[model samples]
Target: MLFIFGISPKTVKTDQGQFVCPICKTRSAYEIKTQRNYFSLFFIKLFPVSKPRESAVVCLNCGTHMPKMVLDH
Candidate 1:
């Protein structure tokens, strides 16, 4: 039997997201530029999907690092 856990695969539409940088420990935030698919190829290597579902948020300041997911409904 396949073990079922966590939220199922789905596409959530939104216009914004938020995250706090660990180093700065400040409310550093950004805006979602587009919607993309989340992928997990072999539990060991999980990351946002590439191609077709290609979209990302861009930091207004430093243009580096991965984007933060909006966890709260």
Candidate 2:
């Protein structure tokens, strides 16, 4: 019998919009992402291995990820 299983991290985009990035210092397109660890079988994701992490706002222009608090400021 052959068995292969592992845990893998996956990042998914949950939302998209425009925001003023603190690092980029300009309004740009952004993607809201959530990262989660998933159990994989033979390179196929089966189930989540851990809780979903806090969402991060990623800037498409400068490729920087910032906390949601940046939107409040």
Candidate 3:
């Protein structure tokens, strides 16, 4: 019997809005994404492991990831 089990991270886009990028200083489309770790079996995701949800805001123009504090304002 052979079993392949591992953990993988999957990112999902939760929201989309416009925001001013601090680095680029341009109003551009931004995407809010969340990443979660999943338990994989034979390269297929079976369930999620015990891990905190990771969130980030990305700018479409300059591809910069803005900090949470900056995005709040």
* Candidate number with greatest lDDT: 2
Ranking by lDDT: 2, 3, 1
For each candidate, what is the lDDT? 0.45, 0.92, 0.83
Judged by lDDT relative to the true structure, which candidate is superior, 1 or 3?
3
Collision pairs in model 1: none
lDDT of 3 by residue, 1-73 (tens): 9999899988888888888888898988999888899999999988888564867888999987765566777
Clashes counted in candidate 2 amount to: 0
Summarize candidate 1's per-residue lDDT along 41-60 as a digit string, tens digits: 33332444543244455443
- Model 2 TM-score, 2 decimals: 0.91
- Compute each candidate's TM-score over C-alphas: 0.31, 0.91, 0.84
Residue 67 lDDT in candidate 3: 53
Q: Candidate 1: minimum summed lDDT over ten consecutive residues — where?
A: 4-13
Q: For model 3, which pairs clash?
A: none
Query: Which segments of candidate 3 are over 4 A away from where they belong?
Result: none
Error of 1 at 30 (Å): 0.6
10 residues in a row with least lDDT, candidate 2:
64-73
Clashes of each: 0, 0, 0
